[model samples]
Target: MKLHISFKISAVVLVLFAITVGMLVDVPRLDILNESIRNLFYHVTSWFAMVFLFIASFVYSIRYLNSGNEQHDLLAKIFVQVGMVFGAAGLVTGMLWAKYTWGAYWVPDPKLNGAAIALLAYLAYMILRNSLTDSLTRAKISAVYNIFAFVMMVIFVFILPRMTDSLHPGNGGNPAFSGYDLDNTMRFVFYPATIGWILLGLWISELRFRVDSLSQKMNDDLDIKSDRLDSIPRLDEE
Candidate 1:
């Protein structure tokens, strides 16, 4: 599918707007959080972007299973790869935010543990893909695994976090990014940041898909050339 020029322009504009507002907007001085609350525009948005990418990956995995189309499989894999990158970024930023707020970089928080486990599960999916040699087998098995993992990840990151106590907001009776926690000024920047990050993730995934497609085509062409060369009669035999 062709990517629209407007989409790229919009992604760029939104990202710039997010940065401008994130930095310029004044935030209330809370007890422990203080200025670190500014990370809400970045760290939280990264996970939101990761979740969006993973959902796309899950949908494409289902499409691949139904259609048996390699393109769908390629898209699913690219989305997961990009999602993993965002997940890692979220983890790092979360740790940094934690250090300032919770007085430790790596606390034994349920949400943090869940995010770590979920990321490891996806990493295992990547390893599984590399271990398989046959393309069809790899795609089919990976699609099944991807669907399962996405569901588990949702439970880990979304459901489980809410059920238990978490240093992070929106869990354990803590206020979420709604109402007073996210004021009118912060909401304007936070929502845009979430969308901007998701768009950036999609753009990155598209570029990876194109590169993979080109590499596959080049390999196919080389294989065809090799077959033709092999079929040619040997000069000595002739």
Candidate 2:
């Protein structure tokens, strides 16, 4: 099979299998807790993917700054967009889980707050990218902003949460990955889910880059064709 055809089929098959597994799997009951832990698979996986994409975006941002190449900037932008999608998914999943477990859909907990702020910072990154008219200016400005947003995301989501009191474990002096939280069964699925989601995010970012490049090439070709036509003169005898 051609590579394109094979990739399309494989993507469809993987997504369908993921849905089936997600629907059929039984969430394990921990100790006396009967709360549904199924959300952990999607929620935690999405956050993992988001973190990986954000890190990739930051790396590309630095590369763009060092080399002044638009390719790095383009990759950085696409990865940030992919990260926002995963972050949004994580936020929605977290809210649902919190509602069931904490008796509230939304809480002012440090982890939740920090996650929201981090999402907003990236959203601003997109906004900043769009606001600039010149390509070079946009690349430089967005690169600087990407670096700042990355630092803020790390500080708010990872560092600050560890320092404060949070309803979520791993925040407010309550470290995450507690013994109570991890089990053999959860780990078996959790590790794969994390890797799978990261791989999926990278795949999506790659597609976005191809789409952007293709569009630019098409527009350039159209412009060249238009100029060629304009250079031709119509006969006045007619």
| Collision pairs in model 1 | none
- Give the C-alpha miss distance for residue 214 in model 2, angstroms: 0.9
Tens-digit per-residue lDDT, 1-238, candidate 2: 0125555555555545454565566555663235456666688889989999999999999999999988899999999999999999999988887887788989988889899999989888889888898889999999999999899889988888787778885566554443445446555556666766776777788778877866766666667787676543333321
Off by over 4 Å in 2: 1-19, 22-27, 31-35, 173-178, 181-183, 229-238
TM-score, predicted candidate 2 vs. hidden true structure: 0.84
Q: Judge candidate 1 at residue 126 and give its lDDT.
A: 96
Error of 2 at 213 (Å): 0.7
Worst 10 residues of 1 by lDDT: 229-238
Q: What ranges in model 1 sit over 4 Å off?
A: 227-238
Error of 1 at 108 (Å): 0.8
TM-score of each: 0.92, 0.84
